[model samples]
Target: MPTGRALEDARSMLLETGRRILAAEGTGGLTSRSVTDRAGVAKGVLHRHFADFDAYLAALVTDDAARIRSIEPRSAGSTVDAVTDVVEQVFTPTTRALVALVISRDEVRRRVRSPGSYGIPLLMDATAVVMDVLAAGREVGWIRRDADVAALALALIGSAHLLYAGELGAFPDHSATHEVVESILVGSL
Candidate 1:
């Protein structure tokens, strides 16, 4: 058996290798053989650390989501701008690939939606940010008092997720998605 520290290092290397493959080639590029080959580890190493490929994928998504969630809201800016900035960051090619992977896999999706789940619950965080923006906007009379913030926020996130994930290869570009989200939230460019 590998020493504890050695095992940890190997796991880290495997994750980093998986991330590089996912970023460059999307989910299709990730597999036990490919990851172990790239990481120069035994074929069983990934399985030893994670029960299966879906588990590994969930771990990767969790890492990515945590990074997204850790971004502190900008101290100075329109709430719309703050939200837009986050949306732009979250819709990068890397993020899109991860989202697409998660959405397409039933087991992974189940893992993501479970309470205390591994993946980062990105939609929830996005919704929270939108709600915060809506509250601030309401305080400043920027948003109408009667706007259904929760519904609008959910709609924005859901639509953007689908667009960014490119489930059907017909989705709008990130810039267009950003514009649509901003327009929906603030009612103008």
Candidate 2:
């Protein structure tokens, strides 16, 4: 039990370290030694927490996803409010990594192909909020009665990626981002 707990604790620490490295030094700074140094753990401790570097990176992404979810407000009143919450939450390290993953052509291919990446609940929670809000909107007749809620949820999530995806290509200005999100919500409603 002690060993298992330690491994779990180390995994959490490494993920936290990964976020700090990304913020402080960008993606290139995410070395195992850096993670150990940031985590204040010995090198082998990081290794013991995961199979290898790829495992660590994947875990970092997962951890950031959780961090993103933590910032999502429970009952945002409006679609714009929801969008604001998402944008603010994603500005964090995990959100940056997620944006990075989708923007980079190579990482995009890998993430889209790998279903496991979405297995983390953090990303899913964002989607869940969309669903929840839409469901509430439906109850109040603020959304379409015959709407495809899941599809709308997916669309909202996709728009978030487009607005926040700094890695894919140069994005338009804030007006573009706001218009895109508002357009999606309007379409659904």
lDDT of each: 0.71, 0.63
Residue 53 Cα positional deviation in candidate 1, in Å, after optimal superposition: 1.5
- After aligning candidate 1 to the native by TM-score, how far in Å is the CA of 130 from where it should be? 3.0
RMSD of 1: 4.3
Off by over 4 Å in 1: 1-8, 116-121, 139-141, 166-178, 187-189
Residue range 47-107, candidate 1, lDDT tens digits = 9889898898888877877776665456326656666666666665666777777778878
- Angstrom error at residue 98, model 1: 1.8
TM-score on alpha carbons, each prediction: 0.76, 0.67
Q: Estimate, for each residue in 22-90, the C-alpha lDDT of model 2 and write its tens digit.
A: 776666566788888777777888777787776776666656555655655443676655664565455
Clashes of 2: 2
Off by over 4 Å in 2: 1-9, 67-75, 99-125, 167-178
Model 1 TM-score, all chains together: 0.76
